[model samples]
Target: MQIENMVAIVTGAASGLGEATARALAARGAKVAVLDFNEAGARIVASEIGGIAIKCDVASAEGAESAVATVSGELGAARILINCAGVAPARKMLGKQGVMPLDEFRRAIEINLVGTFNLLRLFADAASKLEPLETGERGVVVNTASVAGYEGQIGQTAYGASKAGVIGLTLPAARELAPLGIRVCTIAPGIFETPMLKGLPEAAQKSLGEMVPFPARLGRATEYASLALHIIANEMLNGETIRLDGAIRMAPK
Candidate 1:
């Protein structure tokens, strides 16, 4: 779909991948909305991109509905929905602490998996009602997953399960939404220079980067944004989970 002047909503647009995508969409002339739980960061990014910033929790039914409604009222119906809000909590089911608290696992799944579906349902409902474009497409959704979903390391019980759920959601969602002229796709990224990773010491970051077979560096937010833009432009690429990792099938730690 043509992005020019189209309404686009990006969750977790306060920083990292979502921030990059929001800026990219704005550069392409889309009316972008930066939806995030981080109000201050969202405001900063939205101000820079000339998009509206909305404080929203993607996991809450009321919050998601309100956010979608606000976006529609202010920016018109969103034709692009990018699901980038998630958490990566490293925890072992059993460790020195004995057993990991159940709430920890639930939090990861709630925020990473259920949160994605909450926004998706609301976005799809709104987008599906819009008139189809010349290509018979009404909207496109790009979801974020992680390489850990496929090859989770030692301390990723919660994070891995959450992301794996996202990976599992891709194809079925696309097939079901196909008739509505909306497409769903996912991106499973390897270790990247996200805010969370940036907190690590430079040497530790470098060691992690070297794990990739080639390129031997961390993924960039811009690279992820580039693929997302391409997916939006390329209608044939649906029901797919493209790995943004640089040939890195993670080893169990």
Candidate 2:
């Protein structure tokens, strides 16, 4: 679908992949809304891109509903919803600290899996009411998963499960929303230069980059953004989770 003048909602837009996506969409002339728990960071990014910033905790149903309503009121019913809000807390089922706390696992699922579904449902519902475009498409949703979900390493129990759930949701969601001209797809990214990884020591980051089968470096946010834009434009691409890694199948730690 043509992005020009379309209303787009990007959650977790404060930093990392979400921030990059918001910028990419705005560059394509879409009216973007930057949603995140980080209000200050969201405002900065939104201001830079001439988009609106809405502070939101995507994990909460009420929060997601309120944010989507605000976006509709301020911008219009979104034609694009990108589910980039998630948390990746690495914790083993059994570690030096003993069995991992159940709450930790639940938190990951809540924010990553449930949160993704929440916005997707809300966005699709709102978009369904809009008149279809020439392509008969009402909207599109692009969700974020991770390589860990496919081949989780040690200490990735929680993170991997949450992401796997995202991958599993793709095909079913796409099928269910097809009648409404809403498509769903997922991106399972490999190690990238996100803020979470940037906190690691330089040596550690270098080591991780070397693990990639090719390019021998971390993935760039812009690269992910490019794929996202392509997905938005390519009507045939739906219900699939494309791996944006450098042909790397992660090794279990």
Off by over 4 Å in 1: none
Q: Cα lDDT of model 2 overall? A: 0.95
Give the per-residue lDDT of model 1 (tens digit) for 80-168: 99999999899789999889999999999999999999999999999989999999999999999999899999989999999999999
* Model 1: worst 10 consecutive residues (lDDT sum): 88-97
TM-score for each model:
0.99, 0.98
Any residue pairs clashing in model 1, and if so which? none
Candidate 2 local lDDT, 1-253, one digit each (tens): 9999999999999999999999999999999999999999999999999999999998899999999999999998899999898898987899889999999999999999999999998998899999999999999999999999899889999999999999999999999999999989999999999998999999999999999989899999988899999999999999999999999998788
Clashing pairs in 2: none
Error of 2 at 134 (Å): 0.2
